[model samples]
Target: MKIGELSHLTGVSVRSLRHYEKKGLIASVRLPNGYRDYSPLTTETVDTIKLYLNLGLTTEQIAAFLTCVLKNKEAFCAEVLPVYRKKLADIEHQLKQLDQIKTNLIDRINSLQQEEQVKNE
Candidate 1:
């Protein structure tokens, strides 16, 4: 398909697609008529790239992942698994912090309510 069709399918802007091309994340070929042609596989590739981008993976990380995928599929799984584990750990830590904050706020509110009752009496 063409860039317009790819953009519509991937929901990625033309400029972002160009940027991905420049980053070596995706490829495009020039037709004899000077229009760029995209491969059908590019749709899945761009979707993977966008997923990593949304997950806070940098361009360098994405490149490393692509390289791993090219070299060994099992190795790519190994690399991605570690990243997912780390993200899970970070999320758990944040959840613990939020729970602590919630507990502190509830305690403070209860104390304030008790003090107000004592003053009323």
Candidate 2:
């Protein structure tokens, strides 16, 4: 398919697709007519790239992943398990930190309300 069709199928913008190409995340060949022709395999490859991007993986990371795994979870585990685990661990740590912040905010609010009631009495 052409770049336009690939963009439609992938729901990725043409500019982003170009960027992906520049990043070596996806590849296409230029036709004699100056249009990019992508293979059928590119569809699934783009999906995998988008998934990794949404999961907060950088293009370099995604590229490394695609190079090693190519959508195989088992390959991902065997090749880049530490990177995936670190991403998950970073997210978990952020969630725990946010939970602590939430608790602190609630406690401060309760304390302020109590002080207000005592002052009005």
RMSD vs true structure, all candidates: 3.8, 2.4
Pairs clashing in candidate 2? none
Global Cα lDDT for candidate 2 = 0.87
Please give, for residues 9-49, the per-residue lDDT of candidate 2 as tens digits: 99999999999999998899999999999999998889988
Clashing pairs in 1: none
Q: Provide the TM-score for each candidate, comma-separated.
A: 0.61, 0.80
lDDT of 1 by residue, 1-121 (tens): 8999999999999998988889898898999998889999999888878888898767767876765664566344667777767777888899999999999999999999999999999
Compared with the true structure, all predictions reach lDDT values of 0.84, 0.87
Regions more than 4 Å wrong, model 1: 70-76, 81-121
Candidate number of the best lDDT: 2
Off by over 4 Å in 2: 71-73
